[model samples]
Target: METLPKEQLLNSLEHLVDGHLQQAIRHFQNMTAHDLLQPAYNGGWSIAQCLDHLNSYGHYYLPKIQQGIAKNIHLPPKDTFKSSWLGAYFIKMMDPETGKKKYKAFKGHIPAPDLDAYAVVAEFIQQQENLLIYLKEARSTDLNAIRIPISIARFITLKLGDVFQFVIAHNERHIRQAMRNVTDINKRILH
Candidate 1:
């Protein structure tokens, strides 16, 4: 189990969330429907589809984290957090930079091709704002003691800190993909 100061972990996660929120506002704000739905150069998911996929995961995770926090609010905050082996594995796999392997998303998490670009982007931005609030609330709770069930397998659970890391890493991974799609659309227009 990897151990780190609790504040350090929360701060890093907040930084990632802030970056995502900023990127969404900057890159996705004024995009036309055609640009958002435009597929990547490699024929992968479009920018809107990418956010939609993330929104699906957010719908499952954010509430789980919130509930875990509320349930454990009585416990005194711990100074440090230890990542469970399983949680570490999941976070590593979800990280965009270190995890290069691709796996198919679960069917329920897949985004439809006909999504309204504005609504998807708007939802993603709202989710990010909600995540920031959760992160702040988490500071008063015991990060290591609270457990949250994974969305794919509710029977399994991870430390709250680990869940935060995994969820944010997953968001970062797809947000990067969305940005790549934006680049592809720009290049197509230039040529």
Candidate 2:
């Protein structure tokens, strides 16, 4: 497959950040102040905590990506997605036409973030601002030069730009999940 254009990736990064903010803002807008603090489901994070996790992680990734860029370092293999034991069988099961599915259902919710919606949104937006600054200030060569890792059946490496493109697809994947969660949660409570 062809590598994604740099301009496209940067533009998309901007969109994902903005989209995250908008979705969270809109969700909260419809909710009462108290409902925002209620756990999302029986035990899952409330909507506010979800944003807090995203808020924490937005800046959290910077250290890794920055280290990779500055030292020409590649992160440990843990960052990658691994193919399963079914291997080629599952490969055949997937449609080669559509890109990989964005998110898989998982068993558990994480520890809730220790923040309110106001703090979380403020922090999340600032982290995005920092990301934009970093992206703009870094030379194209830096983005093109850094080696980042991913996996299929095994480890593979790509430039920083490619990694972010992959991450953009990943972002859309989770956004879909978040949207679904919001819808499902609202349905359960309101209906």
Candidate 3:
């Protein structure tokens, strides 16, 4: 994997997070509870489920990342980040564009069937807000030096930069899934 400028990587991740914020507010927030609960044409997860699933990950990762950032705050931020082979693999797997492969959600991350739509969306928005703050704080620390533990594989920890990339890409994948559910629902209504 090629080395990336730390600023560039942060900017890219921030842009993705901003898009997610817009999507949640403009699209998901406006959706009706029933619509959010409706499954996609492929019988996949509903919009609320998608957000809830992401929220689960956010709950697990945000604190860990925060701790990592805090521990490494004394270290001056580096100019570039070299992706670990494992980190690169996880990021590629999470990317929606490159990773089309489906995997079952960890039992802990699987969202419950009956969820409060408004509550789920609200939590997702808050998580995005937290992510923005973390990204900014991370600028003061060495992204490649700090390590964050993964929720799925606790034994393996990835570089802070890699975690950010992986988590945001994962969020993008599910956000697209949620949007597709909405679009498919609209098509059905039109028909």
Arranged by TM-score, best first = 1, 3, 2
Query: Least accurate stretch of 10 residues (summed lDDT) in model 3?
Result: 36-45
* lDDT, model 3, position 74: 95
**Per-residue lDDT of candidate 1, residues 30-124 (tens digit):** 89998888888898999999999999999999999888988889999998999989999999999988899997999799998888999999999
User: Best to worst by lDDT, what's the order?
Assistant: 3, 1, 2
The TM-score obtained by model 1 is 0.98
Q: lDDT: which candidate is best? A: 3
**Which pairs of residues collide in candidate 3?**
none
lDDT of each: 0.92, 0.52, 0.94
- List, residue by residue over 20-55, the lDDT tens digit for candidate 3: 999999999998999999877787899999999999
TM-score of each: 0.98, 0.57, 0.97
lDDT of 2 by residue, 102-170 (tens): 333222323254545566556655655666665554433446556555333225555565555444444
* Residue 13 lDDT, candidate 1, scale 0-100: 93
